[model samples]
Target chain A: MGGFFKSSIGRKVAMALSAFFLMFFLIIHLTVNMTSVFSADLFNELSHFMGTNPLVQFALQPVLLFGVVFHFVLGFILEWKNKKARKVTYFKNNGAANSTWMSRNMMYSGLVILAFLVIHFADFWVHEINVKYINVEPADPTRYYHELVEKFVPIWRVVAYSVAFILLGLHLGHGFTSAFQSMGSTAGRKRALQNLGKAYAVIIPLGFIIIALYHHFNHH
Target chain B: MKLKLKIWRQKNASAKGQMVDYDVSDISEHMSFLEMMDVLNEQLISKGEDPIAFDHDCREGICGMCSMYINGEAHGPDRGITTCQLHMRMFKDGDTITIEPFRAAAFPVIKDLVVDRSAFDRIQQAGGYISVNTSGNTQDANTIPISKHAADEAMDAATCIGCGACVATCKNSSAMLFVGAKVSQYALLPQGQIEAVDRVKNMVAQMDLEGFGNCTNTGACEIECPKGISLDTIARMNRELMKAHI
Candidate 1:
């Protein structure tokens, strides 16, 4: 196990595992958030359960946080080590002649996503924590829907969220199948996996975008 | 045809390098790129100047010895051919061509346009071979029947000539494509089953130790490889490593 972790493929597999976890978390998060579009009562109920549940707050949340941190740290470490591999830079490199732009710029997209994560935690997670633990406020299940709608009211926040989601789309565009490729899953199923990845990359972020726009426009 | 060339010139391993320009006229469209270099070298030799150094063997593109980063692409703008195989016709008359050696920390420059690729030899020595008995009891050639699909795939992987073009073209200077081809050439065959686990583990360990970067699935290596090795070989190597760990 130690040897596995130390190997190059092992580190990549570890990255892929964390990516799988985070992508799964995104699906669940979007599903929960999308509930606010139709019925406020259902949205508040689900949000309250998710927010107040002991299993989610104490156990799953910590794992999700660790996964996020682990992915970013290892990603940076890989990028740093990879950079050191080339002591001299190319005089004229035609990277686009062979590879896709998204494949080469994962770190940049990742940085954008990281910035959005910080703001997201401040806007939602921090406030949730303050209300539940720091302020010792009484539980109000009905407040969840109103709180979500209010956050999307400001045009700046809406624009920021929309831009971040689009970048997230670009991140996932290459990352979806890339994670699978790292896991050695590119056998006869490559075409299927690529198609699935394309759909997933488009749909997940689009879902978040629609929710944000829907709330921003329909908050009346 | 007349051409302007910017070629990297370095004295030795410890010395700094810079691009030196030269003019060569009357280059034939039929002449190979290396032949054009030969004309340039002959001119320098006649002028009592130091000739540029580069590697070439079998100029037909099989030996994998010739390496040149021409006009931003490995082995020039052409696909499925080494620098030796590239023809002068690909370039326009009087065009300025940039040539540099394959640059990677693991592949340090020994002189102008020459890098030490012995790191690949070390990685191969780690576990690139299978143990065979020569005690007059050698197995028959027909002992194992390999499927046509596996045999063809193995042949494709075996086509790699250790040219280092993949590393040159990769954005991260990753040797995964080369290593992957090496691993897959064996992993796809029945004869390599005995040491499959150790082969992958030790080879990968040596590769990491060599300071070659990791693969980001950029697909540049595949497009630039003189042998046109597929990225599936990389996936196979990953799978082999996973199976070994399991």
Candidate 2:
């Protein structure tokens, strides 16, 4: 297992598996975010449960953080090796002819997503942790509802979040089907996988953008 | 037919290569691309100029020796054929064809158009074979019954010529297609099951150690492959490697 992790395809599989974890988490995260538009009480109730639940906080949150760090670190490692793989580049490479722009620019898009993560975690996760641990504030059920409304009040934060989600869409445009392909899951139904990837690439990020926009306007 | 050629010229592995111009005339359409190069070489020799150097073994394209990045494509404009199998008919009169060796960090140019693809050989040496005993009474080859699908897939993988076309055309210069083909060939066969664990583990380790790029599912390798090796082999290899770890 250790040897496998050190191998090229092994590391790639690690990236894919980690990305899949994040992908699943995104769906859950988006669903949670979506509830804010409907009813604050319902959203706050769910957010309090997610926040206070020991299993969610201790186990699932660590796994999620590990996935993010592992995925990002492996991506950089792969990029480094990939760069070294071809010391001399082609004089006139027509890369667009061979692959989708999203597929080709994964590292760049991923870097953008990484930058987005800093802002995202800082706005929500860091605040939550600081309030809970350092500030030693008492548990508040409706805290998430107000936090969502408060965070998007800033035009800059809303736009930045919207742009990050767009970039996330670009990243997932290639990532969704690619994760399937990486794990050797898309054997025969390649076309279907590609279509599904496109849908996910579009719909999920659109959801994030809509969530941000909804909060932006609703709060303003 | 008259054709203008732009060929990369480099004396050795450490030498910098640049495109040099030459012309060949009175070329027959049926002559293979290598033969036209021979004609050009003959002309160069008569003039006491150095002839270009390239690699080739069987002109029939099975030897996996011929490699050229022609006018942008790995094996010229034609699909499903190596440089050796490409006929001059693909070219028209007054056409200018640019030819260069396969470029990758692992495949340094040995001279003119010949590159040292020993990195592939080292990768193969890592774990490309089955350890079934052949000297004495080994397990009867006919005793095992493999599914038709498995057999066909194995044969498909076994067809990889390893001409480095995948590495040459890929934006990352990835060798996953080549390594995948090799891995899939054995992974599908019953004879290969015994060593599957170590085979995938070691082979992949060697491939990474060779400084080859990662596969991003670009599909360039499948499209440009002379053998028409499917990208499925890469997926299968990934599956095999992942399973071995578990």
Best candidate per lDDT, number?
1
Model 1: CAPRI class = medium
**Alpha carbon lDDT of each predicted model:** 0.92, 0.87
Error of 2 at B96 (Å): 5.7
Report residue B94 deviation for candidate 1 (angstroms). Answer: 2.7
Q: After superposing candidate 1, which stretches have Cα over 4 Å from the reference?
A: none
Cα error of candidate 2 at position B37, Å: 3.8
TM-score of chain A of 1: 0.98
For candidate 2, what is the DockQ-based docking class?
medium
Poorest lDDT segment (10 consecutive residues) of candidate 1 chain A: A90-99
Give the distance in Å from residue B6's predicted Cα in candidate 1 to where it truly belongs.
Answer: 1.7
Question: Candidate 2: which pairs clash?
Answer: none
Model 2, residue B186: C-alpha shift (Å)? 2.5
Tens-digit lDDT string for candidate 2 (A52-164): 89999999999989889989888887888788888866644655555678888899999999999998898889988899899889888888899888888989988888888
Residue lDDT tens for model 2, B52-162? 998999999798788888888888878889998999999899998888888899899899999899999898999999887788879888889999999998998999988
